[model samples]
Target: MKRDIQSFLLYLFGFLLLWEWLRPVEQLTKTNHIEMFIIFILLSFAVTFLRLRWIWRTILKLWFILFSLNQFHYQDGFFQLGWLSSLFGELTNNFGMIFAQNWAGLTNVFRTLLFFILLWLMVYLVRYWLLNRKRIFIFFFMTLIYITVLDTFTLYSANVAIVRTVIEGFAVMGMLTYFRILAKENVTSDSLITRKWMRPLVLMIVFSVIVGIISPKFAPIWPDPVPFLKAAADKGGEDKAGTGVGKVGYGADDSQLGGPFIGDDSVVFQSEAVEKNYWKVETKDHYTGKGWIPSGSTLLRFGGDEVIPVFPIHSRVETRDESAALHHFMDYTHLIYPAGIQRVQFERSYDLEMDSTKEKIIILGFDSTPIAPDSYTVQFKVPKYKASDLRQTSVVDLEQINTDFIRKYTQLPENLPERIKELAETITAGETNWFDKAKAVERHFSSSVFTYDQTNVAVPGENDDYVDQFLFETKIGYCDNFSTSMAVLLRSIGIPTRWVKGYTGGEFLKYSDDERQRPIYEVTNNNAHSWVEVYFPNQGWVPFEPTKGFTNNVSVDFTNEDGTPAAAETTAPVTPVPKKDLEENSSKSKESDTSFTFNGIWLSIITFLDQHWKWILLSFVMAGGAVGIMYRIRGKWIPYLYLVQFRLKKKDENIGKAYLVLLGQLERYGLKRKEDQTLRNYARYIDTFFASREMSKLTDRYEQYLYHQKLPEGSWMESRELWENLIKKTIA
Candidate 1:
């Protein structure tokens, strides 16, 4: 009876260990009502551990599941019997979705049901392992892997969890090993003997756990792999599916370019500027069908205050001297400058490396890395692109331009689909000049034709073109899609356009801070964006905003056919006005702009959400249903995986593992051996079923290795083939 009590206590403790797995489900994932999951686990243990009849156990589990479901969702009234019919209807619909291969269409109610089924299986597996197998190492190992993986991949810290799990896992594993020993020896369990064994085991677990907790570990030998993994997993210029929704930020790589990302409000910098403008970081001249890549750059090194020779002002475009100061709150070194930037001024002396082709600037300091300064000031030329100058650039007279310059900027991959080129031609059919052609392509991505989305964008496949995919199907994306599509579309028609990455004019905070003349703006990770810059002989590289709802804020002068600016169209800063009237008018205009901006933003958000339900549902289902499906189908998938995994392995250790996998496969194939049967007998039974002596021969080698672990080096090679042959026979 005492032995029975000990066994029961161990089983209960095992159930508690399983509870640790559920803790992360609540904390890490979107799963709610975790306390109810604990309650369900308790009821399951109560029914099974008491050795109740199978029918009674099933009936109680079903009752508790229904009661929990009602408690969780159907909070309409007492019992809420109405949900029963609704739940049934949802389940039917969800099952049809499953049959239709629409995994992303599964409902939350069905997801909850799948989770309940997962819990039921977990309880049954734990019970079976504890009683019949008398081993808990696999489940214990799995739990450790689960915790460590979550700790590494997610924000969950497993510091304390590691210690607790070590103590509890070791304790449970030791006790189970002791019980297995007694069972193997066919010895009756004695309370005093069990106490003697457990006392030392418990002491050993505690002592080892303490040592591990207090030990000074080595620093990590490798950097965290999560970022690289995310890069590969994200919709960037890589061979990966674009299903992930990463947080928006100033990412370094533009190679892999299409995927949805959530908004990040973390501040990257603060700026004080006369007027808000797009801050330029860098430009990429080459666009792989997948994403952007920088071509070879001629590095130009100079002092921080030295003038940058990029974007030389032509005779036609007008420019005004302007300066903006930025204070970075994040750890960053790259300078964010506006169009026609002349130079950056820093408090201390620093050298700079500027990429001629890419136009990326690096402030050099210690070890040749960019010098991360807290603040700097940039002087720039606020360009006023004249309407007549822009309209005069025709592609018909290409003999006047440099061939190398045209080839570099207007480069396209040879494999670029003809349809993409045809589409660009179609969009610009009515346009006369290069600027008009670019404008036509830009205006084509209106909100009616394309939706601005951060999450629903797709990464192009191995053979897919990024621009083609966005322009044809999945006409929903954020800046990357819109800008890249515009760039590619323009380039297809013999125009020079490049992709530019930088921050948009971020959210305005106050008119000024600490008596500064400029308005203070807070730029966040979400402000990181990209756009297209079309190069013209007279205007240099002109920036364009192709994404829906985004404006480039380019101040233009509607110059007449003859070089005269329109007096009525000139802005407040440029136009002459009475001083007092200017102040009052500017104040009222700012008020109107602020009000309209807020109202427009709120309305855009509402409209986007209303039109974007499919992606939202897919994301929601993927958050939980994917986990359930992975767990649910593991049994069916695992054996085939083992066959493939062991097939490539040449190590001798594969002998034992291969043999064990064979046993599992045989049992799963309805060839379960009796409890009293030895491996030799079971092997004989399997051989009889398959009409092959391979299993019996492999079992002899396996039993020999049990007594003496060292075997002939070639034993595994022979046993592996036999194991594969036998397991393959079981696959129906």
Candidate 2:
């Protein structure tokens, strides 16, 4: 009956665990649910029957069967029914469309079921095989590869559901291994795997977490040249590279010579120069039918480097004797003058050595005409030019500049919506200058309903007018939409605007010792940004990051002690602030509170039940009272449970010794003993036969030792053995 009850309890627990694991989806059709339930019930009954005799082996076999079933049907109720239908459907639709869709749906379901079953099988098989074979290295390697590949594939495929399943599987496998290792170590059933595997698993998990955290910075440290250009060229012919030849510009002829098309998050240039903000590659003055092209025809070949001269410089007659005194009249010393400055003469002249091999112009200084440094540090006459004089002068004609370049600014698609143009016009109507109008457009976007959301955004495709979709329907997008919309609006008004991509300033980490000390910078991928670069006449390209909520009023004030303003100060040094350690403290406090709360609740409930119950209640009350008294007395009862368990085990072993001793003592009295009777029963039987005082005493001692007092180690056996030897000598 006891064995039957134990079997029933085990079956109940196993069923509950299985039910929890196979949580059913709510959106399944009623018919599907009924079918699934029937299948599950049948499987459950089979499992229970098998479990009665051999639970572990039956589970392994069931998982294998499920895997086989999935392989046959794709687990989605789809099979390779007919090739002819698939081929016909594909041809009618367009190239493998039907087959691809069917395969995708089928594979999704198959992979889900396969993943679960395989994970269980692998974990069990590895553990079982490891126990017998002890091949730890092979098991570790195989398990690592299997898990890594499984996780990577799922992630790449963007199957979130499968990824979660894989994580759960890993956790279960880790737990199972822990328990099995503990069992092998011969720990008591009540003891958990916390001691055996918890520490090691935690260490491994921490290491993995650390690796994941730092991997992005360490990986992808190198650059990859644009592959999109090559892909476009292959699809379209040489003419495709130039604009408007194919669906996407591909061939060199079609490709814009100055740079790529200015998309939403276009990268202008990336450089390591500390002082330079923009790396100007080429300027467009000529606009062809398609887009802008550089007009400068004089390409000076200095070695292999191609230098396009934007400005023409002519007269340089003499080196000034008082050039050194010019530095005292300057406001700042770090200014870079353009190539056209004629008053500044060369201190030295040098032969321009063309190094085709090294791809650079090497200028050697000679005494004949001292070389003026090609890249020289210069002092700027800043205060001499008033704010009015700082305004840019336009030299090129807007109409004569390559009509193609200007076309990009005015050419809207034939299907361009009227509302979008009207919206742009309304926002910038009051603004007069191009820069002011651009600022107004930027303000409208930054202050409007649009939000930065990566998940909500859509990528541009061949046929899709992604800009229209973003503005009208999806009101949320990333930096791409924000910059793209701004650029288009600026171009519509005949203002040259280009998109720029880079990173933003990251979170600051300050030093612990000094409040004023410089802090370390740690940038992350999340800092990746996109903004706009508007051409300011004299300023060249002035950066405006509208997505960062930058406003026209946001300007740096560089003042001195007497409240006089300074010029030529371009860069601002970012200072870091220390972050408060509140998260760490809060987490620690939560853990401590949770532990105390759990222990308190348990103790309170146990105490309440003890006070109300009858039979075991008195014993529990006594134990509680004893504990309280021990605390009051400052006595050590915390270790009392361990002491009691030890004493009980000792008593059990001594009982067996007492029985053997009693048997030997009985033989000394010249009485035959029965092997089957216990010491207490034999003593009762012997007490009735003998009425002597010694016999009475022996009977009292045996009764007291058996029932009244706990047996001490070897007490009965030693006393009996001594008494029997004395009796044998007297008999002899």
Candidate 3:
């Protein structure tokens, strides 16, 4: 009984160790209702522990899984089969996706089932190791590695988890080791001996865990590797190579483009604006194919009261004056201003520097060093464009206005692929004016053909043009890909376009105490994004969002059939803040609820798959390997199970069933029962190994049962004790 208690404790700790792995899934990834997975795991362990028949255990687990799924999708009726049709439809589509290697296309239900299967397999492995091998160190070690990796790379804080895992893991290993020793030495089970071994083992685990907890932890001697790995992957010119997508903040390098990046939720600044608007840091006129680079720069210094000249409002376009106050969370020297930015207001005397060619503004301190002010107010104009005015404005007007400006903004790398130009020309063949041509190219990237992805993005090779690869080959990437490709495609078609870098208007936190102005908005590193600004001599630079699932909210009036401007101008939808923040914000408001529901679920599935699909697939692979091992090592362990199972039997029918079990154990133990050998002959060969005649005695009655199909009434009691003795001796 004491041994049973200790073994249960060991299994309990193993379950706790596995629980540490699931704890971070919901908080760290986009996976929802992780509590369902937790409940499933607990049930799996419970069913296994009851030592029920395999068929019964499988049935219970299956029903519980269906119950959980019903809660998620069939809430209209308790445990309804309403989901079966949906399940079959999604399953067929997903099977096609798997065949095509489109892992991301898998639905949420498929991912959920895959995750449950993974947990089920893992729990089974833990049970096997604990009961058969009396060891769990491998799993414990793996749990440690898993926790540490997640804590380092993701937002999951494994500090408490690590502590709990360490205590649980060490305790499990110590107890399992004790069981292995007891079995190896053939020690007698006694209350005093069990207490003697267990107390010290418990104390050792407790002492080590306490020491580890209290030990002075030094600052991480090395920097975080996730950012380092990201920077290294983005080392070349995937814009702001040094500043690259390392931690998702604004980067300064635009020398190269392409590569994968992770999301960073760290806040960069907060702004109080009348409405959400795109904030620009700079524009790059030159595309090197790999990434953006600024062209020849001309500097202009001005005071707060001066009119800012970056993308000035043209005489043809209508505008309204608007101002925004920005309070930064980080010390960034560069200014992030909205379109038509006129000037900046500061409490202290300061100067603003503008690289007119790049349209980048910086705050200048007393020493002329670029310094970030804690707070500043920017005044800008918001243009309401007219269809008649913009559509009538042509490239002829732009070239006539400033050939130098046209030449500078329309620059593309000389080696840019010919196919890109062909594709761009094909996309915008019918559009005569720059605005229509730009719009034509913008509509080309639809969600049906392209996806907005951050981590799975590809880097352009030395011979590969970034825009060409994104447009023709991959068709999947984030803002950089969409914006750069748009800029390049427009330039290819002779429309002057420059790449613009900036932050999208951030999430709406809440209304301020006064609640008079717009809601408070907090922008994070994840908001760092890029878009295309097509230059029309009359309309200045107009921002366009070619990235699927995002909009720049550029207002444009369309012409009616009568050729007059439409009564009301159309404002594009709000910018979908690229990665994580948008998904989180959309879940709150009923106004946005319907619009964002699918996107929210899709983002969550993507996020979880992004970090963990490899593990889920691998769980099955490891499960296969475990099965092969179980098969090979069956002989070393199968007899003990038979010994335990038959020890409780009393039915007369158990005599024949128990005899067959004895034969199989003997065969597995290397005393193969020859086909020609009589039962008595096999029994005599078995008796030779352990100097026991009990097998012969059991076999004589076994022959009576095998031939007559019944045991002699009093002979059965004698045969049972002899059968138990011989089976034990064969294993011993």
Candidate 4:
């Protein structure tokens, strides 16, 4: 009975592990995970009760494969049988073609098979440990290490479920060990030891559950620097490289610019500021026809004690000024700054360059090589732009332009099509002023002439101009395509412009009620954008919006001085803030409920104690009773325990202790010998009621031990062993 119970528990444990792998059962079945787990456990119990032969076990395993295939379509109810048959027929009919056509499906099938194989191996291992009880502790420790390693890499699950499963696994192993120990001994079952032994295991489970509930979720402070893991992360980061979730590649010579838009909503940073503003990461003057790259400059190194970088701006006033405190959740090397930043404050010092012309700050030498700051604050002056003011400004004169400045901003590929230049001229034909011309180009793109698309953007072929391809051929692309084309077209007409890359002003989240009481906004990769910055004669660089769905930070006034409303103009609406699915958020919260407040945890503990005080007190009383019973039995049991210990240590010197134990057993059953009886007479008397051959052997050995005066050196030891064996046989 004990062995059978142990076997059943082992099978249940294997099913539990298998269930973890099969999780998220709602995806596979309409049933909830808890219901599925219960059903699986019941199924395991039924399988164990079958007591199948080895061949039947193999057949059962084969049946499991069919059952799994069938269960995948089980949601169809009675129709699943027909669907399975059809699926099997399809597979058999076009085995080779199906393998070629559905390679991913085949891979999934193989992966499922491998998962089941691993589960079967775990069950086999448990069975082996149950039979070889001496090695069970070593296996238990190894299994624990294996499970811990698995939990480290895998996503966290419901804490209660995880803790419960882990504790149950250990408890099941301990129970098996106890049963195996009992099976090796011939003593009658004692409920006292069982009750005492279970108390600690139960207490362990209770404590573990409480700790799991109250533990904070684990997150690494810094990224893993291990080579293989880093490599894997780097590979995974490729798709997210240009996107906002991980890193935005500002230092790359040519950004890999085009791909299907995959949106990421993971908050990389949150900024507390007075109003929304563009957070610039970096800028590049040189466009390599493929992407942007920085013009190489000499390094400016700052010592460890140097001040943080700051850039001054003359165009934007310091009034209505504000500070942005950026809290980073992801590592970033390039510090993000808002436009018109006057001073920057961070924990560390770095060499800085203030480009007053571009209104940009460059970090040349950070005190620490890689600047992975958790948070920083920037004090910036917000731009106060009115369209009337921009309309009044004009372009810089040709002779006033320095040769280097003209060469840099007006630079274009020699192979650029004349049609692109003509297109720019045609678009701005009615506009004479440089500001109006820039506005015309911006308005032309922002209108329905070009469509905004992310997934349909084309990758230019070698020798093909990307701007030309976007303008004339596609007429539909994302922000990079629109911004690049606008910059290049404006430069072709002698209006100098530079392409800028950065994230959009993120959506306002909520207000923080700290000392500052500022608004917080979450910024992610999907907010990454590119736009054109047009350089005016004396006003320095000004930003323009060319994308269909974006509005740049340029403030526009449509009213005239006569107090009459200006004409209604159509403009792109602000981009919608990406929202998370409610179901998904709920599921995540349920799974990740690891964070526990002290008050909440203490309340739970108090509630649990209050509810279960009766059971707890009863357990304590039962434990005390078991201890008292053990004390009472010490006189009889202690000597037997000492004899067993002696036999274990000194194998050659039983000293008739085993025979005396056997005699005690028989005497308890009223088979005591008469005091005056001879050995032969005693044997004859026993033979009348029971078999006497075993009794005769016991008597001869006893006689030799007591009266043999001329015995050999080891004769008493040999007689003691023989007497012990015959006494056991007589008692049985």
Candidate 5:
């Protein structure tokens, strides 16, 4: 009965330990309670039925079997199961279809194994090494020390969790105490009395509980021991997928480009513009047959009020139709702007810089600062060129082109295959104009010759030219491949072209009336794109869309008359608001906010809860199920624990405990031993009333041991026999 009590309490305490460890696993994997429930049932039942050593062995064997089956599922063809041979092949083949695909599946399996191992090890230590009271105390002391060590590594914010674990630690101490008591020898009923050690043990446990509850919270002095455990929990609870921007990586550094691409639709910025436009971040002139590189020229710095000198060719372009009205706000580091940005307005003064070519703008701040603005408005003049006008311009002679621009844009590695040049020449054979030649090269790639595939895009190997590999071999890739191939082909025929990188105008958002019904575009990292910029004589540099299905609106002008610049289109100028007008608007907004109250916030919360009540109920059900399963498992361990704790660990105290048991048994049979009566006197009264000498003999031995302090040889054995004889008679 005593052993059963110990086992019951120990089993219940095991659940607490299991819960703490499982909480950590939640972060690492999406293990549902059903899976945990199955594991719990298996382990608890095994502990109840199997010996300490066999339990661990059985768990390990089961784990190996499951793991092997999982591996067989992932293996190729029939050969994976064939290795198991006739002896194991039948078993392996039976479950060959069940494979562990995600980390969560694997994590759940591993966590189950770990939980069982911990339980078995704890039982082994207490049953085997915890022999005497001193050893039991030492074992508990060591356990407390380990708990302290764990405290340093646990996430400091989970004080409640820490406290619960500490309480479990006390339960372990209780278990150890019981185990020690159960290990004592068989007792003679005559010498039964409560041990003096019981009071001190109870006091110690109470003191420990008080200390655990009242201890001051302190900051952890070292790194958390299970950092991944906490990280896994936080991520496991989230509904989002994959790491953000970092996964799609930016194009600021060209060396990082030209690899497999994944489109992420997560919006990065929202812009209100006159029309959807290709927002350029920077231009890359030097291509190393692998990736592009900047010219390494110093950037020119300017204040917010300064007019950035962007255009070197001012005379030929008509500015009236080119001005694009836009208002942009984004919390991102890169300053994304449309093809032509002439002026900007900001709420506060900020430092800015333009690259050496004065084509791209860079918002300036400390290196650590992410470039963002509360809000900003820009007026850009996009050069509109008609296809008729571009088609009419004849090809310029190589010597007539700007020497510096020609040298940079026409750069190609010496090892570039000659076939590339031959192909470009063959495609443009009939085109005399530079514009037509460029268009012909662009058309060849934009045709069915290539297909856009992000995952299969081939990266150039060592000693391999990227453009050569893409054009001749793979012929399947995304924007970078098509754009780079066209740029390289155009350069082969003396048409200066450079690679430009930035985001494409993303999906159009709803129209905004506050900004006068301008179309809003939301751009994301998935919108990161690369294209070619062709330098046309006298008309300045223009963009060309070589990528299939993607249009560069800035490069295509439908309004131009035949072979001539179109009539300029004008835009309304935006005027700044006066200080008094801003103040009036702020006051009016404050007045409008008066209707919302704390009660309104509560109503919104209540409405949300009402709608999500099913989910809330499901959560409660899972929690209840977990608790119920643990309790059900606890039921099996209770009986064995009574024997192990009260019988085995406390054999030295049994003489006293057995006598108490007999007294209680007698009292239930209507032969009560009064609290005031001495054991010898009670035995005499029992003998007189029942005419039993068996009780008299037991009483004499008790008096000899208690009054004379005698421990004669075989005296305890004699007492045991006499007490049993009297108890048998009393029952009759």
Candidate 6:
């Protein structure tokens, strides 16, 4: 009963640890589940200490069988069973971009399989050896140590290690030992070999480990954050604007782009415009503990084969007089651009085509536009009035949206520190409207009193609330904390706000030629940024950046000495090499060091064993020195088979010596036998001594030599055999 309880507790603890690991991803935390897990762990300890032999014995049997099966399953493509998204998540978290970025000639799948096989084999051998000796405590201790060390290295290096096999081996060994002990205690020696439970238990443990090792990829139903083109295709269609733009073109698979940066960091983008610019994409409305996520879902539909909407009002459109006009065309066929687009009036229009199948509107034109049109004209109106103007209208629904947003925005942890709430209140004490309150919070955060740094984020624990840590002790954090805290504050005071992540500041470039002048943009990860977007019901979403002043934004100027248009001058900091590039260099250096170390150690050991093998031989070595060294380094004990083999060799030589002497004695009695004749057969042929007790003893000795398994040199069987032969010779 006690052993059963212990087994139950071990399972319980494992469940709880898994829950803790998964809680963040699932966004769930249940106290009861945690408590139950704790109770199980406690119970397991109790049972282990109480030595519940039966329960342990049964558990061991179960674990060994399960683990063996797990090894077999892992040898297959178990880890690749999940959907694309799940695979991507696991890859990102585990392998990071090391494998993704470097598409080397190496076959990753085969490499992983080979590694797994080797690991499994190593574990199996070690565990088998340990179990045979009934060293339960040593087995468990080694297993735990191996797992801890291997997991730590895997985490640091972002790769799987052979340590997993060690764990499997140890568990199997423990189970085997427990079962062996139980069998010995419960059954008589004659029947112990047939214990029915042993084989099945070992099988179960092997199976379990095999299953655990194969992690399948699971594709999420919805597109992750930014919808992928492939995922959209799978889903039939995509809603681009989340309003009324049916999925037109194939969704772009951005999985390779690396999911949107969750933290605050700047990304640089080269731009076509002479002056640098910032492009904002979608924003966040809700704040999970780690980062911002959309608050609700939105739907979008597109008009098929219908004329695009056009307003009647005439509006003037012109290229800036300072620069040449850039001629562009607009094909409103299947393309779904952002909403609020007005007119396509250009200084000089170009040829255009709409490819329905491709869902693209292609336009061909000169890089630079002609001079400003004499009378550029367009028929367009702003999609929505500015927020300031909409504020004057008493719209109940708009007010509610704002109110609902604020409630969620300002949401704080139930057990947040009082000082954090006080600081928030003080920062926005006099702010009346939601926008003003938001600005106040931003201003306080942007102030010098709050620092911006990445390394100071608090580790997870009670009293380690993100906002409190960032606002009080750390006073510094990257975009994650900043965006999360701001979103919370805004929601608290009735503001409809969401966080947004996209490229921010970028370098602008312009090229001029005889045919035409143009500009292009190049974006880098340093331009990645996070900020908040408040919903001004009528005006839609407008972005607000509180961390802007913390980092310098590069700008460009395009002016001549006379203040007339010339060429654009770009200004920005020099771009740095990517982090992966540095890591690769570091890895190369480490590999060189490791190779040297391994060669040196290997040579030294080989030399030592070659020279000092005599001392090893003195101990009745059955195997070569190299094999002995290998066993010693790997912590595997010498096998009994080797000892038996050594003894057999010695006994065979002794028998040859005795045979020579016996032949001499037989010759004196005129019964000399050929080398091929057995001594006992010769004794039977000699009538004088055939029926004597001496003949029987001689027959016994000869029979032992011909049929009996050899015994060790010092064993009684070896001595007795020699004595019988001696007695036979004396009687003859």
Residue-by-residue lDDT tens digits, candidate 5, 181-266:
54454432221222344456657767887887788869754322332222222211113331111224243555533444333344
- Per-residue lDDT over 8-95 for candidate 2, one digit per residue giving the tens place of the 0 to 100 score: 4333333333332333322211123323433444454444444445666566556544544445334343244464354344445543
Best by TM-score: 1
- In model 3, the runs with Cα more than 4 Å from the true position are 1-228, 231-245, 397-399, 559-578, 581-732
* Alpha-carbon lDDT of model 4: 0.59
Q: Deviation in angstroms for 297 in model 5?
A: 2.2
Pairs of colliding residues, candidate 3 = 237-255, 237-256, 237-257, 238-256, 238-257, 239-253, 239-254, 239-256, 240-253, 240-254
Candidate 6, residue 659: Cα displacement in angstroms equals 43
Error of 5 at 697 (Å): 36
lDDT by residue (tens digit), candidate 6, 368-478: 322222222222222322223323323236443555554554454466567765676788886555555655787777677764432223433443555666667766555
Q: What is the lDDT, from 0 to 100, of the residue 416 in candidate 6?
A: 54
Candidate 3's displacement at residue 391, Å, is 1.0
- The models' CA-based lDDT, in order, is 0.77, 0.40, 0.77, 0.59, 0.59, 0.41
| Candidate number with greatest lDDT | 1
Clash count, one per candidate: 5, 29, 10, 1, 27, 66
Cα error of candidate 4 at position 689, Å = 46
Prediction RMSDs, each to the true structure? 24.4, 23.3, 22.0, 24.6, 24.5, 19.7
| Candidate 6 colliding pairs, count | 66
Candidate 5: segments with Cα more than 4 A from true spot: 1-246, 311-314, 318-330, 365-370, 387-400, 555-732
